[model samples]
Target: MRELYVKSLPLQDVIANLAEAFETTYFISCHEYRINVPEGYGSGFIRGINFSSGFGLIEYSCTFKESIKIHFSVNKIHPLKFIYCSEGIIKHRFEEKDSLHLIDQFQNVVVASTAQNGHILLFPSGQKIHMNSLEIARKDFKTKIDCDLHYVDKNLRKLFRDLNARNLFYYHGNYSLAMSECIDEIKNNTLLGFTRRLFLEGKANEILSLQINDFEDDQKAEPKRQILRKVEMTQIQKAAQILKSELANPLTIKDLATRVGTNPTKLQEGFRFTFGATVNNYLNKLRLEYARDQLMIGDLNISEIATNIGINNKSYFSRLFKSTYHLNPKDFSKQISKNVLLEKL
Candidate 1:
């Protein structure tokens, strides 16, 4: 993955000279906090690319003052922008249509243009706006309708609202704090690189699914059919409990399925649907938890600990331990011991 930062103002001159630049519009400025982008140009209006991978491109803009108008005209590229307002408000006029008024500390808007004619407006200062542009190729987009709709679908919007409501308890309704934590982790934590991105994408999809469910519920539509059978559910529960009890053992999905009297496919699907994680994922989590307890309480060498946890592959076990804890096993053990000594002091 590569990241690019571009902020050259006197953007008025850039806008005048660069006819090929793309212009996108956003009504809500608060959505900027949700984007992952590089920081540039302290106070003035700034534009830069945050991250670009095989997944897509994310561009950002942080503006302090509002000019009369700002224009970005690009080639034939369709990208989605998530805008966040840090301070004031912005009225957005799109395709010269009636202006859409949005105000608040934060908001998220997704925009895509097919042919031409796309524009946006920014209001007075005291507020800032951030933008993330995700580029989806037309060919790949057709193959992944579910992935595409995950961002702009109405159902996903409701899901975000619901999750935001829950997050209010965490951040006292300050969306910026919640968003900053996500972005900070994205920037600082190497372990979170791919998984964090995947998680964000999954959250977007879940939001979309929730919106669809809500719409169906509102119209009195029948619920989506579930694929899990009673037998499957029972087997999944059994396998999970067994895995929980035996975290030290080498566990395979096939072996778990056999023990639970089900096939591997059913076992995998049932565990995921019922527990929100695959069997191996759940098992690894369980092992990590047990390993933590052992590290804190037991006097054991790393190899001995790994053996006791049923991880006979010591090197693989060490890697998993470090990935889970962000510290090598010996270091983690030493840190725990240090904490214990401090408490005694």
Candidate 2:
């Protein structure tokens, strides 16, 4: 198994060279540019085949300005590809015949061989692939397996999706500095070499364990269902919306209950029942979200934004922000600047 690193080559040239080197009937190109590969590859024409270290290979590419096209043959073995868009939008067409998958900034598209006709092509701003077979083989020979891969397979995809979605939503929607740090760690540090493979194998089993525990608890739990009437549900939703929209204003449970035509106690209970948290907790979340947006966009001072979000005490606001996000306002602000610098690099 070899690690191939190619940079600054024109997309067409890379594809032509790769096809010939691999001696395959066709080569699939997954990139952000339009590339044409000539037939009957010869000298300097790309062709070669190398055993991949893992079941698949991970490749990273970036494009500035022009869009690129990738070509892949129908019969080639396809490895699952995880495309992460850091900056620009990428449009991908699986085969010559399918509708293109449009991936926007900060979003990811996962392509599996199971879905494609034995081949997958991607057009991405940047991506990382985890070749499963190569990785499994390498690990299988070197170490004794302790976990069940089959169990992990059942839940890994869903867990990854959930983790990705949560990170994406927080990243895009704006959250406090603490949340941002967690997101960064999850993005950059969560999956590496051995750890990533272990996660890929054990995540599903871990999730299953949790689910079983939850089910056991549920079985032992008293079954008192709080059945909300339609009107009650509508009022709870309205209250949540109001809280979200008016985070800067002073709000009380009584005020929220009055707005929803319910008593404060019932309103509190209904909100907890519907959202799984107290109304005050929900409001704090909204406030933190608002603060996060201000921090990410760099438009307002932390104190001013905090004040506007009804946090009159500056010290208290900072503490709350730190508690919620793991980073205080200033550090979070600085971290955002750092991310911008990394992006530019």
Candidate 3:
């Protein structure tokens, strides 16, 4: 769907004037600017938080029955903004001449800090939109981050003073499993009052953190992937599907290539080219995500979930799970208690 790019700002500043059409539930605490707009222009909410560490978050999930182009007229240097689309379709463009980019299902786009330029997002008529938009103030994150944040400092620049350096940087990739789960948790969480607001705020932060983590992980794992033919790309994607669908049955590189009509080297190369990760690394990420999904459902214990995924050693599974998710299986389960109730209008 085509979108109109009227004058736009960098999302955060566009709030006070967010289509006076909707009746909104707005809340601001020491760390959050949480608002729920469920009336006037269809139903949805925009939840935002400014963390003490300098980075911040803003999440947008709405279903619109009308056509409107919300403008983010950039006045100052914009921070790094990450936009994720789990459902529906969205079109984005930095300037008038630039081709409009689409972030469809299971895809995300990153916009690096650059000269203050307007950006726009269109909610085409009759579209059910579900998306998460995160803004990270690089300067704030930089102050607290002693460890190299991969490419953050370099990729996001203050080009106003540095005339020689290019002014634009952007990144596009598949949405990670952790991000998907966090979005699901935000959309479905039923807690109320302070508890509900806090839960949503925490989950939104996780979405941003996971996406950055995945970006660096992918960068280190796969750099400078070789080009492939269209047909080879298709076969390689098939191998990826096999990995995603058959998580319990661990398939060797040769087996996957054979099943997809390719050799192991090509399989390995193509997996890197297509997903920015080797087959084994991609499989591990997917399997751990699968385990997380199982844990979220709360049907099985840690040991049982590990065995279900063909990991016989519960201790080993816990270690792997903790390394990736920053929390053990037991802790994660307790983190998502079923007692919380969803908020209703």
- Candidate 1: misplaced stretches above 4 Å? 1-226
Best by lDDT: 3
lDDT of 3 by residue, 109-134 (tens): 88653466656676666777777776
Q: Candidate 2: misplaced stretches above 4 Å?
A: 1-230
* Model 2 quality (TM-score): 0.35
Which of the two candidates, 1 or 3, achieves a greater lDDT against the reference? 3
| Count of residue pairs whose backbone atoms collide, per candidate | 25, 28, 9
Which lDDT tens digits does candidate 2 get at residues 257-302?
A: 7877666755766767677788888888888889999999999998
Which scores better on lDDT, 1 or 2? Answer: 1
Q: Which stretches of candidate 3 lie over 4 Å from their true place?
A: 1-13, 19-40, 147-166, 192-205, 217-253, 257-345
Q: Cα RMSDs of all predictions?
A: 16.3, 16.7, 14.3
TM-scores for every candidate against the unseen true structure: 0.34, 0.35, 0.56
